[model samples]
Every structure is written in C-alpha cells, then in structure tokens.
Target chain A: MNNALPRWVDYGLMPLISVIVAFVISGLVVLFVGESPVQAALLMAKGAFGSGYNIGFTLFYATTFIFTGLAVAVAFHAGLFNIGGEGQAYVGGLGVALVCLSLDSVFPWWITFPFAIIAGALFGALWAFIPAILQAKRGSHIVITTIMFNFIASALMVYLLAGPLQKSANLGPRSRDFAEGGQIPKLGGLFRPLGIDMGASPLNVSFALALIMALVVWIIIWRTRFGYEMRTLGISPRAARYAGMSEVRLVVLAMMLSGALAGMMALNPVMGDQARLQLDFVEGAGFVGIAVALMGRSHPAGIVPAAILFGGLYQGGSELAFDMPNITRDMIVLIQGLVILFAGAMGSLFTPAIVRLLTGVGVMPK
Target chain B: METILQLLDLTVRSAVPLLLACLAGLYSERSGIVDIGLEGKMLGGAFAAAAAAAVTGSVWLGLLAGIFVSVLLALVHGFASITNKGNQIVSGVAINFIAAGAAALLGNAWFNQGGRTPQLQSEQRFNPIELPLAETLSSVPVLGPTYQQLISGHNLIAYFAFAMVPITWWVLFRTRFGLRLRAVGENPAAVDTAGISVSWARYRAVICCGILCGIAGAYLSIGVSAGFVKDMTAGRGFIALAALIFAKWRPVSAMWACLLFGFLGAIEIRYQGVALPVLGVVPVQLMQALPYILTVVLLAGFIGKAIPPRAGGVPYTKER
Candidate 1:
C-alpha cells in the first residue's frame, strides 16, 4: 500500500481531498435548506478568520482539540479506540475544580496551575483505567466499554454537579465561581505586546502547552522503545504475543497516556476560559477528536493542523448560526461526520485511483 | 395490583424500541458486519417518521419515510465497509454522527421548532388499539383487567415487535438465506467457494437491519410519543446493543433481555423519588447507569462468555 502511494500523498493530499469532498456534501445540505452555500462559505470564512477575536476563539478551541485529538491518536497507535474521551474530559474538569476549590485561595496562579494539571490528568487516566484493564485482562471490547463509559460519565457528571457540587441551591447544575488565582489570564494580554491583538479572547497559555505536548508526544511515539513495542502490538497482536510483549502493561500505559491528554483538555476550558466549572463544557470536542485523529492519520504533526481546521469550522459555525436563521451549529457537526466518513471509512476508494492516475501520468513506474 | 399492571404496561412500551433495535443488531452481526450505527439509524428513522407524519397526516407514510431514510443510511454503510473495504467501526461511527446531526439540522430547518416537528394529530400517530372485549372484560375477575391493560390496547407496532422475535429466529435459523447469511459471518471464504456472493448476502442482511431499525425509530416517535424530540432515542440504541450482547445474540434471549431492561426502566420511573430500605432514595442516574455498567460487567465475561461471530469486524479481502 505504501509502495502504491507515497507518505506525502497519503498524509497530505488524501486528507485535503477528503475534506474538500466533505465540504462539498455539506454545501449540498446547505443548498437543501434554501441557503446559498457559496454565501455561507464566505460567511464562515469571515466568521472564522476575519478578526483577531475570531482567530483567538479558533485557537482556543484548537487548544482543547489538540489535547483530545492527541488523546485519540495515542490510543489509535496502540490499536485501541478510546471514545470515552468525553467522560475522561468531564472527570478531568472535576479534578480541576477540586484543585481550585481547595487550593486557589491559598496558592498563586502559577502554583495552582501545576496541581490542577496533575489532578486533571490523574483523574482522567483513572476514569479510563477500568476500561483499559477490562480490555487487557478480560477481553471486553474496548470500543463498547469506552462508549458505555461515556454514558456513565455523563450520568456521573449530572449527579455530581447537580447534587453534590452545586453550592447554590437556586443555580443550575454548576459550581461556585473560581477565585482569581484559579482563573488563568487570557493570551490576549500576552499577544498584544507582540503586535497580534487577541481582543478580549479566551485563548490562554494552554495553546502553548498543547504544542509542547505535541512535541513531547512526537518524541514518545517515534523515539521511545515503548512506542516501538506499542506500535508492534497495534500492527499485529499475534506477533507481539510471540515476542512476549506484556499486553496488560502496554495497554494500560497507552490508555492512561491517552486518558491524560484528554484530561488536559480541561485546562483550556475550566481553567483557561470559563471561570467556573460547569456542565457540558466539553460539549462534543471529545467526539470531534475522532474526526481529527482520522483526518490526521493519527500523527501529531497532522493532528495539530487538523485540530485547528475543525476549530475553525466550529468557531465559524457559531458565527453562521447568528446570520443564517435556517442553518445551525449542527451543520458543522454534519461536516464532522462527512469528514470521518470520507477520510476514515471510505478512504480506500481513493488509493487505487490515485495509483492509476500517477502511473498514467508517468509520474511513477507502473 | 393496578399500579403493578400499569408498570407492566409501561414495560411493554419501553421494551418495544429496544427489542426492535436488538433484533436489528442480530441480523447485521450474524452476517459478520458490526452495526454500531443502529443508534444513528434509529434516530434518523424517528425524526423522518415524525416529520413525515406531521406533514402527511398519515401514520403509514411516516413509517415508510422512516424505513426509507434508514435504508438509505444502511446502504451508505454497506458501500463504505462492504464495497470499499474500509473500517466498519469507523464507518458506523461516522454514520452515527451523520444521522444525529442531519436529523437535528433538518428538523430545525424544516419545522423551526428547535429540532422538533409539529405536534402530531391523532390521525398522524399510531394510537392505541383497544381489543374487542377490553372494555367489557375490565369489570370481571383477575384475568379481565389484566388482559385489558397488559395484553391489549398497545399500538400495532408493539405487537409487531413481539411477533418479530419468533420471525427473526425463523429467518436466522430455518431459511436458506439465513444459512447463507450466517455462513458469510462465520467464513466468507467458504461461502465464496460455494459460489454465493458474500457481498450480496451481507447487503441483504444490512437492508433487513435497516428495516427493523426503521420500525424501532417509528415506534419511538409516532407509535409512543406524539412527536419527535431531539435525541429522542436517548441512548436506547446502545441499550439495545447491550441487550443483544446480554442475550448472546440470540433472538429469543434478546426479547427477554429487553424486557428485563424495560422492567428496570419502569422501576426507575415508579421509584424516581421514592426511598428504599437499604439504598435510601435511589438516584435516577444510578438506575440509568445500571444497564451500561451491567453490560460492561457481562462483556468482561464475569458471568458468561459473549463471543462474537468468528469473522465479525474483519473486512473480507477476496485474495486473502
């Protein structure tokens, strides 16, 4: 397969083509609703990238997706599908809330941030631990268990936020606002001095952290011996078993790593943007991670840009919602589904055609 | 006794969609194609049925619309996995998102009721059909009201759901197509060697799945509720998936499993705010989470094994 299509074509051109196809289909959907897709596209473009504020919002969303997309990518590399990122992110936010509620009054912002990171990751990993252990030791299909866990996570969050965590009896399922130290300053101030005015945007240092994690993830996945063993297991479980790789050890570690990255997504929302931890803040970003991971081919380098692209769609879709009374944010979700359909599921349809075209054009030997 | 009877009646209504979906899963998985998109198809079907009924003022048209849209989505899944040899799970996931997103988007766009269709009239929905002797028999002994409340007065779809259990069993075990379908799931190579088209059998099986899921969706909206609500399936498709696993993919056992889950749901509704002896006031979340938790426990083989078909989840590459 690799011999038929080069890595550049596989990673770059193929995904770009899939995205275009998805957008075209989405345009048809827009057309069905009696809206002009061309105008909608222009509105989306202006909405996503027309202003510094929009760019900041897009980056903020990308920062969250970067964590979740990497989470899915890590698990994918280990031959596991962790759809429970939603649950894990929710729990991770819970961990952040606990850290802030307990220590924010005493500690400074810098000190509180580190503990929140650890708490979030630890909690997220812990949420995924049961499903991983079940898959490794009990042969409970990881996909089903993770999905069940997602529902369970939603239930658990409702229980906690609506019952135990709700300090004010009159308020909705939400917690008390965090103190000053708990809420990190936006990157708007940091960017203004650099001539990039991120006007009143929620973008924070989490974007930088996401990039750093990407570098760290790249090193771990490609450079480490553990990565080699994990990839081997993913490629062929039989061969990995023959080589005496510990399925339990590798699976648990890989899932925990995946879970931790998902957990870190809370930093962008609960800590970075929202001053208070609330219900449904993760929204569907966890699911969007699946689309990002597939489109990116489970590579960090690909994932970063893919995350931003989805982030742009999300930011733009909200903007479109206000202008187009008929169109909604669900249109973006439709695009997400189309992307996954083209890039992940039916991607094989493109391979042979690409090979034939390349051969016919005399670009490659037959 | 009246409360108990009413609980039993509610169980039947609640179990119908789960039963439909569980049986739908049975056909696809037995044919060796994992159908994680059952929820999506059901959701899509529910919305389509409700919208169609709202517009046409006919329940049958709604059911047809539901089945048509579901089959269309199923064909898309078939094209992706069966034809293109792509990842079935990924395709199913994509289908789930697409159906859900499309249902909501189209609903809001068309009706403008925040993703809900108009309030359906009695003629546009499947109202309960009272039996011939239901009213007359209600004043008699124990068997009288029981027959009236428990056995009778359900919409036509509920009876159809129960009838499907035996029908599905017969189709999967007794018929020639069933033999070929089961064979394809178990060993497509053997089927191919025998000159039967593996793709054709799987495609037919997928269509059957689409029809059942379509009915399940219709049961949710027009049959049970007055109109469609966003996410009205409310994870029932996944619960049905759990029931399919709980029943070990057998049609008869699937019915019993759905009944059990439905009974639990009834109990949850009956005891929403009530207190129990040891547990105190049970949380609604706990009751809601129990099915998923039990499914995980069951899948771990703590109680018994739930092994899938031999070739399930694997794409059949002809040369291989």
Candidate 2:
C-alpha cells in the first residue's frame, strides 16, 4: 500500500529487521533457560552447516516448507486464507501411501513416482475442494472452514492409520514400509563428485522437484493470465466482480491449486524421507508455511530463503537442544512466533520509520 | 433417570469452558476485533494458572495469574489491530504460536516435567463446593436429587460461569458502556462522530475478552483437571468461536448454543465405545471431529446464516 518505499526496503529491509528482532528475543529466551546465548548460537551454526549430513537434513526440511509456503501464497493471491494446508498435506500423504502400498511390490520407483505425484496432488486438491466450494457457493468464510477441515483431516488420518492402512496390531498406527518402488533415492550420491560425504542424510530428488515447483509457481502467479486474475481477485474483490470475473471459479481454482501444493508437501516427508504414512507427519508445517509466505511476501524468490532459514532453525535448534537440555527445539518455535508477530502481524511497524529514514536520506523525494 | 441426570451434569461441566470462551469472543467480536487467538490465549492461561497454582499452592493466585496472562495477550492483539492497523488474523495467528511456544518452553524450563506442571493437591485446586441444604433435601420427591446433582455441587468457577450469562446480558443490554461497545462494532464512524475514541473502547473490550478467556483456562486446569497438560485447552477455543457464530453473537443465545454442543460432547464421551446397530462402533476420531464439522455445516448455512458484526476484523482509520 505504501508505494513510496522501494522494493528492496519493503521486502528485503523489513524482513531483515523482523528476523533480527526475532533472533535477539530468542537469545534472551536461551539465556533465561540457563544457557549461554553466544554458545547456543555457535552450536546452532555448527550443527546446521557443520557436515554434509546436516546440510542434507536442512535441505530435507526446506523441501517440505517450500511446497506448503507456495500453497499458502497461491491462496493469498486469491483473497482466500487456506488454513487447511495441514489437512490437505495429510490427505495428500494418504494418496501417496495408497499409491506406495499398492504399487510398491509391482513397479519400481520410477513407475510409482509419477503416479504418486498425481495421487498426491489429486488427493490434496480433493481435500481442499470442499472448503473451496463452500466458500465460493455458500459465502462461508474460508478461514473458519479451512481450519475446521484441518481437524477433520487429522481425525480422518487417525481413523485410516488405525483402522485400515495400519500394518498390524503389534506395531504402531502406521502404514507398511514402502519397498524399492516407493522410496525415492536420496541425493547423497549426487554430492559424491564434490568429495563430500553425505552421511545418511534424507535429502532426496524432491529437493529438485521443490525448486522446479518454485519456478513453476512463479510463472503460474506472475506470468499467467489465470495468475493475473487471481491477483486481481485478491487486490480488490469488488473490482474483479465489476470486471465480470467469475468470483466462484477463481476462488475454487485458487484454493484447489493451493491445496495441491500443500498436498504435494507430503512427497518430501513421506516418500522422500519416511517412505510410509504416519500420524501427524505434517507436524505444523502448514502453520509454518503461513509464517514463511508472510515473511516472503508470498513470492517464490523470498519463500525459498525463508524456508531454508526455518529449516536451519529446525535442524540447529535440535542440535542446541541436544547440547543444552534446558533449551529445547521450542526456542526455534518461539523465534518463529516472534517472526510471525513482527514480520506478519506487526509487519508494518517499521514501515513508517523506514519511510521517514528513506526520505531523510534523499532516497525518495517527498 | 440417574444416568440422564449424570449426563446433564457432564454437559454442564463441559459447557462451562465453552461458555466462558464464547463470552470472551462475544466481547471481542462485538467490539469489532476478530480474535482468532482465543485458542492461544486459553492455552497460555491454562499453563499460567496451573504453574501458578503449583508454585503458590493457591487456586485464587492461579486464577489471577491466568487472567493476567490472557489480558496481556489480548493487549497484544489490540496493539496490532488498533494501534498499528496490522492484519488482525495474522496477529491472532502469531499470538497463538507465541503463546503455545512460550508456554511449553517456560513450562519445561520451570517445572522440568516435560512441558507439564506438577499435579496440584486439593488445596491448590478449585474443589467443588456444595450448596447449603443440599444434603438435607436429598430425600424430596423428583426435584431433590435433580437440584442437588445438577444445581448444587459445581466448583466456584462453574457457578461464576453460569452467573456470568445473566451478568453479561445485563451489561450488554442495560449499560451505557455496552451500548457504546456494540455501536463501535456496528458503525465505528458513527461512534467516532460522537467524539468517542474508538481505540480506547476497543482496548477495554479486548481486555474484558482476555479476562473471560483467562477464567475459562483456569477452569479447564484447576476446576476440572488436576494440573496443566500441554495443549490442554485443545480445540475448545475454536469450538467456542464456532458457538459464538452459531449463536449469532448474542449473550443468551451463546449459552444455549454452548450447552447444545456440550451435550454433544458429553454424548461423544459417553457413547465412544458403544457400538450402534448399523455402525459397528463409533470411532473416536469421528467424535473428535464432530464439533468442527458441525461448525462448517452451520457456516454453510444449512441451518442458518451466521452474520458477523459489521466492521469486524477491519482496523479503524479516520480516512476509511
């Protein structure tokens, strides 16, 4: 809304300050937990990037966030707040599990992978389809319906895992382990030419898929007519309606696309990492996507870095927790909360100050 | 008859938290502040109350501590929405995450019991208090046991929750402050024209919302449960929001709506393992998902349309 500020100041400077504020507060929390903040920071850095193994883990986590972040961004572009990413991703995992369980013994990985993608996207889109239709047709708020769907999806997942897909009564409520067909090959072997030992990291081909999807999303949202209309819908629904754009179609399509992206997030965790569907595999990644998309300004260029940063936080926070028992991974969660607070909620707090500073510096003529 | 009476009692018990949270939402939403962070605030209050009660061994202190923490969170929401004119939903989401993370981090660090406070003794909890003559009149025909079972034996907070319904109705319908508060939600410009500070009125409403939510959280921990469990408020906050919507944001209607949902919850707990004639056994997940599903259906206008307050979720600006 403030066109006076340059793009760099708006996107780059704003998020930078928010991240800094989040970090400083997080440091205070670490100190409160009876640990040295400086040492915790050092341990976190070393833990996130110390070895190729850690990098792989970081990338693995990043891949999950990328898909979910894009999903939220797509919905954001359509004036829809899709809080059902958790549910869509869960249902998408269900689709992947169905494909893996059915075809694992019959086909190899390559044959099953494409089908899994289709199934994942289809199932995820299907899960999102209901809330989308409800919002479009009934004028029901997407936020409430989508959030309710998350709980419903969770319940559905529990029922499926325990009732039908469960392997046996002896084990926990999880699907059978996928065979060679379902398990995507990790990218560790690809790093061997650089003389780096990947060391049992779970980074897989999904990382490339995630990157490609990011580019695809950029094209879909920016370069396509459908994307333009969705953005128009978001910018001002009244104007879009005046222009004779079918509000129902745009809302439904945008939500389905968003849900598909969220559903595809299951690929990174299920097929790529665990190779089986389990309870709560989404693990609040959908919520994390909200923070990511907001901080990224719903752009792929911004989302990738944000995703990686959070991934590092997840990986490094674990390392910190291992070393300092009092400081758990929740420290990163606290930082995430602060980031969402500063970057998303109170995101415009620094804008007025930045505008004044920029004008004072003669960067912009008042 | 006895089982029916017990179910009604359980219904009242479960409905108390929902009722308190619904009233909380009523105050905030009626003031035109969309509080998606009700869940988070209740969660934070639950942790604060349990931890305080555990430390001080006084349930009163726990209730105060819970209210204090919730009010702080409500202020955060108010600051974002009113002062900064930031996105209300985003602020609420941030509040939820922050409360959730901070509660866990602090609980784990302070208690060292894996994100759970130490179990409270009777002295540290809000034990149920029997009304006078409850035992003496137990032998009276059909009315005696009903009065004793349903009306007489809930804890102090439970009585306070019921008492709040009439008080809230009185305040909202009869008081001058309540008129201004409702006026702000409906037409902030009109209120602004009257030379009243919109933000100040909203801040007060948000604070009131916070107090009610804090009481709800304290009730969940000290009133019903022994101690605080992580995520103890569960989805009660959201369900309360749903009840607010279903009740059309009115005070007395909210009570009826919450009691209905509470009855459903009581039925869910009672008939969880019982197999019906057609369906083999009702799944636990089905029961857990019912409230959310019903809210969605209500939202879809299958039963009735839920029209939110005018100007709700929008930050007030003079130009706008």
* Tens digit per residue, CA lDDT, model 1, B1-320: 89989999988988999999999999999999988899999999999999999998999999999999999999999899899888888899899999999999999999999999899988999989998989998999989999999999999999999999999999999999999999999999999999999999999999999999999999989988999999899999899999999999899999999999998899888889899789999999898899899999999999899998888888887875
Candidate 2 pairs with clashing backbones: none
What does the lDDT read for residue B191 in candidate 1? Answer: 98
* Candidate 2 C-alpha lDDT tens digits along B67-145: 9999999999999999999888888888888888888888888988888999999999898889989899989977899
Q: List the residue pairs that clash in candidate 1.
A: none
Give me the displacement of residue A57 in model 1, in angstroms.
Answer: 0.6
| Model 1 CAPRI quality | high
Q: List runs of model 2 lying over 4 Å from the truth.
A: B277-280
- Writing each residue's lDDT as its tens digit, candidate 2 over A236-349 gives 999999999999999999999999999999999999988899889999999999888988989999999999988888888898788887877777767888898999889878
TM-score for the second chain in candidate 2?
0.97
